[model samples]
Target: MSSNKITLKKIAEIAGVHRSTVDKVIHNRPGVSDAVREKILRILKEKDYQPNFIGRALRNQENRKTIAVVSSRVNSEPYLHQGIQQAVQEVGVFGYDVEYYIFDIEQIDQQIEMLYTLAHQKINGIILQALYDARIPGVVSDLAECGIPVVLLNFDHPGCTDALCYIGQDSRKAGRTAAHLAKAFLHGSGRIAVINGYYEKILNIYDRCSGFTAYLAEIAPAVEIAEIVDSSENAHDLYHAAVDLLRRQQIDCIYATSSGTEGIGKAIGELGLQDRTHIICHDLYPEILRMLREGMVWATLSQDLEKQGYLAFQYLVYYLLKGIDPPSKKILIEVDIRLKENMPET
Candidate 1:
């Protein structure tokens, strides 16, 4: 019915029979009842169908496309990992194969090179989390030159070539939105300190911190911005940094824009400052989600992790197969503000 050739499954729908029944009828397998067989034959003749358009017979003729999912340490972030895994699951059902590739977020250059090296291979598609690097434009160009399509997840790499289609939320805008929510919850007056996992290194963290800082400064100038605590991938380092920072400042509010909330929560609880300070962070990890519902964290900003993974695969598959264009320069997903009343229990 559509411009694309109708599949046998579609024909089966028209005949009101299982696709296998259609297959058995077409191949003369003799499993159908006489009436059903006659009905299928009539429908097949009406459609004038002569062949199975999609099957192992045509598999090799079409490219057995390989989609590469390159992500950060997904194991550390459950929801993000879930999103990536869900996208991987979608690949099998959609007739594409996926190869997962991951690297440490700290090793930005190495991660970029590894992605470029994969371009040298037969991979037709890439799902990437764009990191902070000056060479991303060149890397994007190389992938485009090699006819590989790339879909950016979560983070946006500026100066990317035309071949890059981004399917994740706008990192900076997500940050800004979180800041406004923080202001609303805090009532725009308090000394708030910001906790960012990759302060100077990650674009998403920087943008979120920036948005939070800007909105807080605009409506709540009286509220002092205490020093920003730089979170670590190392648990011990993060706990000590947050604890020591909290010890020195009269921090009445805290905003976290990354997944380093576990250590921060422990440190905050150890200091017994939950009564005085209102804590707000991002992501819906098991710990963070529990903290939000338990009133340990006053609120959290969430982006749809599953939706991100699902859309990332969709864009990469589209470009790799049909060279279909993406809709926008950057896709921005809405930020979710979770309060004690609205937070889900894990």
Candidate 2:
């Protein structure tokens, strides 16, 4: 454990405290005052002390356990894949073999079968995002009954007792933020349209849309929200939907609760309405990146997708091995507003 070489006595000496005092603070006992706790923490940080994660892994029977990251098909959205990949890579050093399984959305039955197969294969953990099924609680219970830890990402399964923790942004808050942006950009009231990605059944979409609607109804009473429109999770459909809505309603604001911002940008530009109406989108994808740079989209509610995936697994590891609850419950990634001048190039 060379990497974790420093002893509590050494840290205590530097912190000007007795070994037992330091130990009490380290274990979060109430005897240590907050001020002393801060000082000791400062010393630990300054010394760059890192625990022997490898040694910790070797001691646990589940060391080098397999973690499966399951999601819908990668499709055209490379950002989703990138974020999940980066998360797994970041956690790989801790002795978790992270493998991604992209399932066909239409064949959910097959997907369930595949997961069952993996369950028999000795999967230690699962990080799931993108598309939720109602039958999830049963499956999750099955895994928990077998001692596998489950971490739900992006979406929450209400009755799933097996979900150790859920780490992601608040869909409802993002919706409220979207509403505020819509009101400001529309200058009070204008016919606004919202576009959603294709969904057979999913929780994120429902939550996001519900939040958006609820917020707008409360804050901007006069703003007319257009009827529900679905774009088949395809960029082309998204572009056309934007065009149709803009042409018909002279839409003063547009909100897309999914990953179709790039297509939306194109439609807005082609109609020469980019300068007229305000556009707001979710997920700061490559397409959305450009619109934000061009002032086509006024603001974006970014959930830091990479961080979401990374933290989900990180929390799962904490619970599975350490026997501790995650530091946060219902983690809401901060909401960030991006404008034309402030948008960073991806």
Candidate 3:
């Protein structure tokens, strides 16, 4: 058979399989055995066969496709809720139905269980922001075995076999940026205290802290690290800790690796260190913005929440629809550093 004249029917005949089987293999659908699928694929490659992927995608889109979004609940992270909402809107335009399974990242077992339930529902794809779990790779592997594509949101599942991709910012760079802003505001000589969220569990927070300290060590060695505090995502605890640190140490700068600005700002206010101490933090949450405007917080690193959510859904749709793999294993979003001087008029 001429390569130029190759067709699905001709390929099916050459492979000694039904045209339906060829169709399934061409679209990467399961039910065909691995050996047989490989054989069919080999023959197609030999013939230089190009399937009508666009037509197939159009027909598939006619069916109501289901994509599951698993992330932290709103109370855990209101910013994530904005992302989830954006994702839903973006995917809905492409005729993909999204179902959200909100969970607390602190509840690792419950989050894992929800993943199992979604997989059991035979979801076409899953967008997850998983809590720290050693068993996550196994769970992702199980879903892969069942032919479900998984895209991680705001985090990456490195070494997970067949995990699709991660969508989020370059955390280390954001941290380094925070350090730059802090050093400039403090004139390169100040005692800095680091405030971070669940540093052991959340890799991003750790990366940010690492990046900030690394930069300071390289460039602003005079800006000393007075102390490091892990808030464990508790505002009250962070406030008390911040107050204690302020009262004891001459903390001229605060580098917060997470979104607990409200509590940190309160501590700075109580100590009347609002003008004396310069604080840098992450995210543009309402409270953080308020602090920035009030001159309590110096700068914030924003990881465009809406764009993260929109792109997460968009990439999954591309994979499930056009059979395109993620452009890369990890997509690093641009970090927007917002400060009072350049605060956008919302």
lDDT-based ranking: 3, 2, 1
TM-score of 1: 0.79
Model 1, span 217-256: residue lDDT tens: 8767777888887775555666787888888988877787
Error of 1 at 308 (Å): 0.8
Error of 3 at 258 (Å): 0.8
272 Cα displacement, candidate 2 (Å): 2.3
C-alpha local distance difference test of each model: 0.71, 0.73, 0.79
TM-score for each predicted model, relative to the true structure = 0.79, 0.78, 0.79
Ranking by TM-score: 1, 3, 2
Worst 10 residues of 1 by lDDT: 52-61
lDDT per residue (tens digit) for residues 226-261 in model 3: 899887666787798898889899888898887666
Query: What tens digits encode model 2's per-residue C-alpha lDDT throughout 225-244?
Result: 97667775567888898888
